[model samples]
Target: MVTKIRKSQRIHARIVVMDSDKEAVHQLMRLLGKEGYKVEAIEQINKMLEKIKNEQIDVLILAVEAWDNRGYELIPTIKKMNRFLPIIVTSADDSIETATRVREQGIFFYAIKPLDIKEIKLALKNALSKKFVSSGEALFIQKEEIQKAFDDEILDLADASKILKLSKPTVSKLVRNGELPASRIGNKWYLIRNQLLEWLRVTAAGNQRNYGTLILETMDEGVAVVDRRLKIVSCNSAYLQALDVPRDQIIGEYCYRVSHRSVVPCDESSCPVRQAFRTKRPVKFMHINYDSEGNEHYCDVIALPMKEKDGKVAHVVEIIRDNTETYNLNRHLNWIRSFFAHECRKTLGPIVMNISALVDENLSASISIERRDKMLLSSLCSLKFLHDMIRNYIISCKYETEKLQCNKKSVYVYKNIFPQIIEEFHPILSKKGMDIETEIKGERPIWCDPDFIKIAFSNLINNAVKYGTAKTKIVCWLKMTDDEFEFNILNEGVGIPHDKLYDIFNRFTRFGKLAISGTGLGLHVVKLIVEMHNGTLKAQSGYLIDNKPITYDEFYANENLYKMKDKNLRKFARFILKIPSGEDTQKMEV
Candidate 1:
């Protein structure tokens, strides 16, 4: 509801609202109608001039999108037609140029959207009342206010005392103390109704109460407004946390001293605030700061300049937004780049050298069958490494761009995803003389993205082969529940340490003392694929450990989970995946 006040002019006022957005028009109409004002909504700005010319518009409410430049150009034309008509402008763009233009037009109020409804109502009320006061038309005021204005433009101290129902001596005292809006003309004090109302409002609300401190305190971004001297005039809670300082200790201190911990101002080339002041616009930069606990923090800082009278730079407002997550993500990406570059060189160099040897040996003398077979195997390994690198890189890029779409359907385990994985890993298992068991708990067909699920399963099986010991028993099983499908792969070997179970899913992770043939993104890509399907992957291993619940490998041989007398512990690692089913699984497929 609008803040109600006694109107000196009782007749209803007319308001015209112009906005291309249909919802904005309906909303403004509803709000204005509730306040007893007749609202005329206009959508087309080009036709607004003709429509408004005929209407007795007391206030014109205009909101313009940045792309609608023509709508903004019409502000002065409307004002020229009705000089006393108060125009309140609202813009989607909160840039300095928009604010400066509004100020230049002497707009009664200008707000940036998405604006609070209460703020818009207040701005409208202020614009209307300002017009009423300046024009003396009393379009939105009480009848008595008009009569009083006609009687005298400036009421004396005695008149003001009577109007306010206060003693003349008290009014004189308030005037003398600068508490009232009255000023002495030669020997007597006089006041205007506009000035008196403004003074009373300020006195009741307190001048500082209307400031943006409340908004700043509630914002998540760190905000600080500083003077030209770099002294902090106002700082929000986020800013206090950013600087790791108490409010009492920081309010009066220099900003450079607090933020940079320096005695002098910031470096000219690196200071966004100084740059903003110099450019008379907003300037942005990224920097690293540290918290009280000594952890480095990455932040993106934006500085906006405030201009004083005569268009001179006055103050600067700085906003800090944390980008630590993005910074770390980028670092991980760089690591991947380095690791991939090494893999490419390591894979390609061997193949090139082997090809050269084949040509030389074949041309110079008859090449032995043994040497030919060895060179062919080397090329195969090189091609496999290159293929895996390209595939993983493409998948990672797709995930990063949010373009990794999953086309899901009903997939038969025995017919679709399972047989291919078994066939692919059969060679590795055969070489190690390992045993593989396939077990099904329920129905065979499950709903999922068959292709990606195949990728995820193949990666897990390959991981087991690469890290698990030779001559081990590998178990692959599918267990169906009432609402979900579960897939499990377990192999007996030197398993992951309990402490590193979760960490193994991170990109570029390598475990154990053995050299593995991978760039370490296989498991990370598997994790991303599983998460995309709204599923979970858990890694578990059983090895020698004490009775501690976690069962880490750090325990001495004297512990219980290993063996009774022997310190040597056999290791087994398992990967479990749970994906929801029954309902429309297509929706679950990202």
Candidate 2:
């Protein structure tokens, strides 16, 4: 007709190529650009969804090998995002199964690798010109025709239940409750096939929403939904609890204002919610939030997008898990490591210097024999201290990681275990001018792991010798009760404060004197060992008054004990270990 085409009728299409192979993508892009079409290339699968959602893409060339052969899996989601967008899948796999699966996903074409450029061009031209029947539109058309046919087709409750995949009783109840479109005819409810199917679809959709709500409510992790405006749409109990905010105040509130108390939103790079909305993809990151009282909390946040029908992000579902306690524990562990390193260096520094001097012939010759012997003894003590510390640390780690198991057996604690432990510590006892006075009232072979018992008592005695006043007595009482084995070690030394007594057995806890060379794991390890044997450990430290053990609290309450002289007050610390000896003792053995 020789008529000019309208501006709106001009053919201008955009094509996106998703491929892991760079050279292939470049060649395709150049070919498409030369054909006077706008082309974009994406190498990462994560970026593909965002590009499709943000841009008006007419055709997509998806390489099956891209994202490790997971490219085809994206076809369904892509179709959901844009029903009319044509996807031409390219695969190196020439298997019929792959081609069939790709076609079943409703892709425009399946092109095998070593692709023909001319064929791809022709497919592109056809895809651009072809009219697409969206699934939603097709479903609507099918439902209209089905409804007309169903006008004459009637079904009873039993028949409707089969089609709905529901129990007959459920269908009857729905009919009784007027939930399903049905009518009573001759005492039996009858439903149209189309109406029954329609009712089932609506009910299933509602059930899905209920299931989602139930899941969100039951989860321990905080979950919340936020719209694009940064306003919270809904939240679970945990979400409210995490922020310590009232439920009434949380709904409809700006997420930034509620969580951060800030006027502006959080930075998109750090905020998972914002990033999910911006990228139209799932995001995960660590977030630091502040409570109502301005306390910092560490949280692991995962934000997933809830997309609209048009492939735009409508809301983000944020899952928050509180990691504040775990974070603090890790920080404390790192601090313990640093402290341990410092202790090792402090203990080794003098030993290294002493050894260097001993190695120097001139230095050794000039030193007195008595002084050299003292140095040797001091070095030996230091080495023993370091060795014990390391051993305790290893045992403590084993206990924490649940790798330590007690091999329990019936053993004589007083005769076999105590003697060896005493003999081992004889040198340290003599050096510290300490004497262990044992009052043995238990002669029975207790049911326990002998090696573990030895280690337990050794740690207790070592602790007594370390802090007990020089030349003071360490009184040990071993008694056998009808139901349990009782052992107590009372030493006159630095008394623990009332507050510090509560956490005395906690890992890496040290109090009273910081200058003492101890790993702080000795008592903790002793506690673990005692517990492993179905026993209990208790510590009491204070002065004695009226032949009764006065606790730190009593000492502080009484003005007389508070003002008493240090020498007369008689500060003492007693640790009691009691192991059950009843019938359950047999079960303690692993």
Candidate 3:
């Protein structure tokens, strides 16, 4: 019953063949033997189970004619014994009914009896390709103990405790207390390692199964597990819904087949699955997966290898976290900061020249006093506004990367960050003839980057001024929740049409009152800083039902419903910049 495959060390496999026809069975043996395959054939139903347990097998080829309904009966038991084993069933009947019945039973293959050598070889090759098992056999096996019990009862408390290094008394106590299963052997108790190990495996598998189930059941993260061959094995409901995958069509398909919409695997540069397999390590990247309907989603992906007992990789587990909002915002912020920085640099020289000319003209009396003073004042105001804008842009960029450069101090958020932004923007607000105020409903610093928060709020206030009417008041409200701090800036002007609320945050979307010249990146930058602190940003424009809009709905109908109102305002673009926190920002600079 012991058959060990050799010669083709590259092809490591064990095969078991059982046939009732003596002459046909010998023919199979001759063919397999000539091909240098180690194969065992058994005719008796009783002997099949024993041979399967004793010998290692990559495949089991059973002749359905061997024992009439007996072959059908053995299939379930064999599967239970080892679910990974591939079973190929053959029948001499060649009837469609028999083939159909065996197919329903989940046999790996169904072939007519007196099987063609070609068919058998093909089935065997296909089965062997997917076979995987633990390695490193131990020499100190307890044969006597293994022989005394059935497959399920083979591993007993005595053997398991011995292998696990627990005292027999403790093992016995565990068994007696129903913590472990034990069988009575006359007047003594016995533990078989096979049974005990299998039990341990089942329990361990159960724990992992439940853990995955819980995550998929409740977690917002979408997850999927793909095998080493790049085949998708399982996915959670969230993954299916997020990917918009047709469950029946995807279950047996390869990962790339579904995700990339490719006929073959993606090329080396784009294949995260291949990298994970090649390096035997986890790989993470950001990707946008689109379904058949062409709906795109932003996903943060992590692929981890699942190793076998020998430490060889068996599969890869992929966890995808959606980050569309964060990514778009960061992208928009970078563009905004870069563009504004360029503009400020360009305007500085001109403003300085204008001021010098005005001073010289006044001193020389070459220009009228009124004209000189007006020129000087306008130039100064332009210089001041541009300088402030540049500073805010720089600070916003720093905060986005968690590298805000300033003295760090502990102070209540309302007392420090909020006041700084309000004070800095007060002159600009006055110049614009806009009234702005801050109301703090919280009293703690809440452990945050103050300079970052200040600049972020400054951008918000500036946006409100630039977009609102000249005589309107901008209300800045700060509220601290159980685990987060929220800030809201409200302005009265031509409100952002509901559709454009989400669109305005997009890098190129500058839609508001006509007078405000903007890069359409200010709100995008604000969103980036807010998210960098693990907070969220949202906007609503409309009067409150109670003349005080506390919730988004109270201000206007849910903006999201009006898809065409302003498509890009409220839904800001996102960018992902991997940077250290304020505490670790020094590492990047140094």
Candidate 4:
């Protein structure tokens, strides 16, 4: 028989929220609980499906993404088990492909990122209106897969045998052995379907069911239920224990006082509780909370809205998970990054310049020499490499700290940073039997820090000289758009391996087996400095043919679709950087 719910009072069923996202699971659990439902939220996909198979479920909310197909693959299983069960798919990936894939599974709805309360409610209401399959109809859909509320409604021995797939004697034997729930009525065996479901779940769990206070006390995440007045109505053991406060002291206190020790609200900028109240939906945020001793810790907070029938928010369920260990590790990493950055600038810059000058003087000698000249040139190269490595370390540090401050001054890229870098690296390229070709379109003044700009350009050019094939021409091209300045350094080298291209900008990530000596921080530093100037950068690998490759004009023509127009060419590497002119920097407050 089909069961339908027309009101919250009639929703005497369980909602299974199966999602891998922790915040999504909590939010959906709160929403379902608000509608007077017994919500069972499980994070692991396998465990969730196991519950779905064992327990009686009315609605299944799949709110998982950022993982893989393990969550989505369960869609077909839900359909095959019970054709009447509703699956509501939610994901942050709102692409057309994603929507089409969800539609193929015949889901009730596809909710995009940042779900709306109204949309969820409307979908649930629609889901409840549909009637379930009759027992005769459901029996055709694999009896082993049918575990629902109706399975325990009521059935005589004749229909009960169909659900159990056992003969009357065997069924009676089980009932006689107390393995099943049944009673004799007028010389015939009869049983409640709900009892059969309870037996199955208990037998599968190998213990008593967990619910109500038992479930609340065992949760690892701190949960607090607060009313509209910001007073805590109730809290679980985890909350009291996490705060190290007694239940009597916490029950009637204001949430703000206990969590932040303040009379006012938490950070007004992006508090999850405030956002949830304002939007009338679930909201998540990371907050820094302190203990009684003033030690700070990071908490991932999710505020779930629980609304009354009249559409008023009666209470909010807040889940707070501690992430202090992750926060401290990040703080230490930042300190290391900053220390290396400062060391490089203060000590190594002069050493490289001194060695270069001495090497030049010796190479310009009037008399014949071989061993002494080779020794001086090699030492100069080594010092240059050390200087570059240190400089890159510092740049990467600035980027992570978000301390790469912009000291904007009007300057021409072609005249100031560009020519100076070309002159500095020209000798190295010449020594490699290579030459740099430049194409600078009508230069314009840009607002930027000249020193960082020079450093970024020098890194790109020096990378070409160090890594490019000897005797191949290097291309340095610049173009000015209305809002941003674009630059590209094209080198004909063996090219970054296709497998390693994605990680070249990552700090300390060296590409696959290139003989080049580097700190592996050069590209990462360039990326950060460009971002500081409100710019962007990318590396595309392709090949040049017959001493000719895409020119500045050709790249501009297909700038919209320039990456891989063809696959038959030799592999070459191109680093592109774009800096916005006079763009504002968005700095978030601590």
Candidate 5:
């Protein structure tokens, strides 16, 4: 379908010349005619397009300075007419800027005008070789009197995908499911094309116990072979079974058509196949794919380039590995850590704020004894709540470091942990008039560590109470699944930002405001305890509350905690604590 004819293939090849100077064109045409090239002269840029469309042009030779823009507009116009056609730009001016721009556009070759015949022939050879054989001239083509060329390794499923231009899932399923004949080395799967085509010819004859059939019966992945231009030369049974895509739909299509699901020609810098061809280096990428039902899959893709006889590339091999489960587990773990950190920090800020206010106001001098006693009791409760928070954090850290242990003792988990946290937060919640609700979904007497779970629940509930807005209800509940238990605390308040969700679990990471007096350890301790118990914990900020959704980003963004304030002793203490967590954590002796 390509328009440009190869110079060797033509009886007397036509050369298209675009130059403003008549003397130069006349002289060039005379020299070219003597060298057996028919000259077709065109002066205007607009006429050059017509000449390419109308006449048979083997090569386009243009004067760089004469076209004003060096045929930048004409290059694409001519290329659009014939993509494979070779264009040679000759410059009387050898400026680096012009050369760099020409090279950047992927020109066939660049040289000074009043050109040497030897250099032009070599450039023409290179361009024609690429135009015929593609990128690296590595296409495994054998002509009469010429020997066939190939790489040492067997062709792989990756190679098949490239040749067939199909998705990896479709290909891998066939290869790994034993519907094709392919061998594996470590993680790489390969196929032999010569053996496969013979098998196909046999299979078409309806006698199936041949060597190729036996190999296809054993293969665990899909396999196909492609030329440098990514045309399907052959395929096997395994490839068909895995892809779930009919061979008639994919054979002879470009590689990216199936893999990338794109119809446009690839931009060199952005195309993975082109990158491999340009550098002759293998590349592996982990990519995510989503199905129509919204299920996600993680795929590991590896692509390697094959070279032709002229040291140009002719083919590419691609392999795909599915690792969906592993990706999900890691993503879940990260989200859990982030949620806890965010919720814990939000609760921590208010405690610090109340403490600062308490210290500043002299309650004894102005308030009566009854009110004073009430206020003092409230402050003491806040301190105890803070203490319990710190304890939860320390326990979480111990569990992470593998230092937490269970005694396997029977204990009343709710009666012990609930009362302590509730008593500690009673005065504070009472002052704010915040209603606290707790419910045990299904209590079971199973083997468990009471104190660790108590601390974890305490952190979650306390966070709910502290950040829960005035007149809002904070509900705490727990449920038991088949093999695991779930604890949830819902509070009507501002949620955490989506961007900050991942970083909340790291030690010493305070999300917003220094108003809360916390050790930044609650969630870390919860994570540790969950790990120790072989359980998991997760925190969510933007859940529906009483049939209404709250936007947290704008809420937290406008908070006073985000603003700079006058320095205090608390800030100094935080500054001092920052050093050990930064450099000392890595220096912790074995």
Candidate 6:
């Protein structure tokens, strides 16, 4: 049964309802009025403070959803106006976050939406009774005694445990350990509420500091806190690990001494920490640092300033990330670019000079027909070499940047592509006294990008001719299976070393004669093209024994082949390429 307030007591009590929902406000007003309380309803939040200030309000029912939930923000303000006013909060939101926030604001009671009339009546009756008791106590106790009671408000074990959200045993342990401010009186422990609150505040702040420290310790990047004097105040484990120093040796040491191994500070213009302090803002830059053992590192440093209440920079937090590997890679790429440019100029210079000499009337008249023909041939060879170099370099770059795409079509290798490529290399082949012998067993047309296949064959054939011994035969073999096509090229020469066989396929890698002028990107480009078509390329180099080819691995395994003299054994280099044929090619294209 809902207990109603007595007629005499309800005559003086004033209850105000603040909500945007007119229907809920009307219901609350009618219910409370029937209970003999003088109830007033106000929709506007702005008028709430005015209503309270002008009249004596014993209870306030505030809807948190009113005025876009600004009612929660007004709790502290309302309390400041009348500290003793009983505020009952109502909300449609029943989430724990909302309930916790409302309860923390010192509301008398919290009710979910569609407020229960019986519950509100009971809460109002209890609030008024408590207010009357408080009024009576105020009159009985002297003001000085009330102040004294608040200062020394005694609490038993249950009260302390409840307030601290801890079990009784834990609270007892705390009291026994002297961690909590308490006193033993007549076999029971008593605590002061004021002292306990102070202890909680201090403990909460310490936990926050510990949380921040834990976060820093878990990071992969090195983090350090430095004071205004550039002395390291504290650092995480990563910072110590990066510097390869003990924590005791790092703390309180100068940041410059620990990071740069310098007696003085680093240059202010380049130091991100110094810049952050000067600007009172965050700064980031790259830095070169040395560890304890003097190993150099390229570091990316970010510094954020810690400011004081007066807006003055107090300290700077430095975050260091190692970027040495990336820096070295970029430097190496830059060097390769420079080398390519030099090679282009060197090749082009000769071609221009030769053409100019032939064009001059005086030079042409002095030159014999035989010499003129030789000069033309030399110019054409140089032009071809330059053309091949530029084409391979461009293709390599396209593949590297992921812009190269193959246009596939059926191609007869021996009939259309191989013959043309062989004819193109005739000049160089005849000059070197080398001959190419082909044994093609495949009659089926291979599904591939004809242009790319042509380039791949040209590169292989060129390498074979360039490195082969004079009067040696370069063997080319092609065979087709049910699902794949295989091509192999074998050349007799001063073969590539076993260790460098795989390395020769890398960009700008050359293992052959240094006197021969050729771009190293040809083999790399061929490897890229082959891989793009879902194919594989491999190289083997060793000596031929009994007309049968023996790889370096096999030769090393056989003691007899290993002991053979250079004059007795014929060295050879071979490359094998395997590519998917016909319908198998469509899967990779997709």
Residue 244, model 5: lDDT of 61
- Can you write out model 6's per-residue Cα lDDT over 237-288, one digit (the tens) per residue? 8887777766656766898888778877888998889899999989999978
Cα lDDT tens digits, model 2, 1-590, are 12222222223556789888888888888876776667888775545665655445668999988766677876755654455567999988999988988898888888998888888977876775553233221111233533444343556688788998889998888777445666543356566665567656766776765566678889888888899888987788787777775564676689778766776887878888989988999999987877767888887888999988899998899887778889977976885688668987888988898888888999999999987877776777788788888888879878867899898777667788888888878767877888989999846667788888888888888888888889988999999755689989988888677787879999878874557878689999999999998899999999866646787877778887778646577678889999986564434432
* Error in Å for residue 153 of model 4: 19
lDDT over C-alpha atoms for residue 170 of model 5:
73
Whole-model lDDT values for every prediction: 0.70, 0.76, 0.63, 0.69, 0.57, 0.79
Ten-residue stretch with the least lDDT total in model 4: 132-141
> How far is 158's C-alpha from truth in model 5 (Å)?
36
Q: What would the per-residue lDDT of candidate 3 be over residues 411-443, giving only the tens digit for each residue?
A: 466775666666666656656677866677745
* TM-score of each candidate structure, all chains considered together: 0.47, 0.50, 0.38, 0.43, 0.33, 0.50
Model 3: lDDT to the true structure: 0.63
Q: If the candidates were sorted by their lDDT against the true structure, best first, what order would they fall in?
A: 6, 2, 1, 4, 3, 5
lDDT tens digits by residue: candidate 4, 240-270: 7888876645656888888766657876557
The order of the candidates by TM-score, greatest first, is 2, 6, 1, 4, 3, 5
Which residue pairs show collisions in model 6?
A: none
Which residue segments of model 1 deviate by more than 4 Å?
1-224, 227-333, 355-371, 426-437, 441-443, 480-483, 512-514, 544-566, 583-590
Error of 5 at 469 (Å): 0.7
Which pairs of residues collide in model 1? 7-142, 8-141, 8-142, 8-143, 9-141, 9-142
lDDT of 1 by residue, 455-554 (tens): 8887888778777778866788888655788889887677887788889888767774667667677888888888987999998876623422223443
> What CA RMSD would candidate 4 show?
20.5
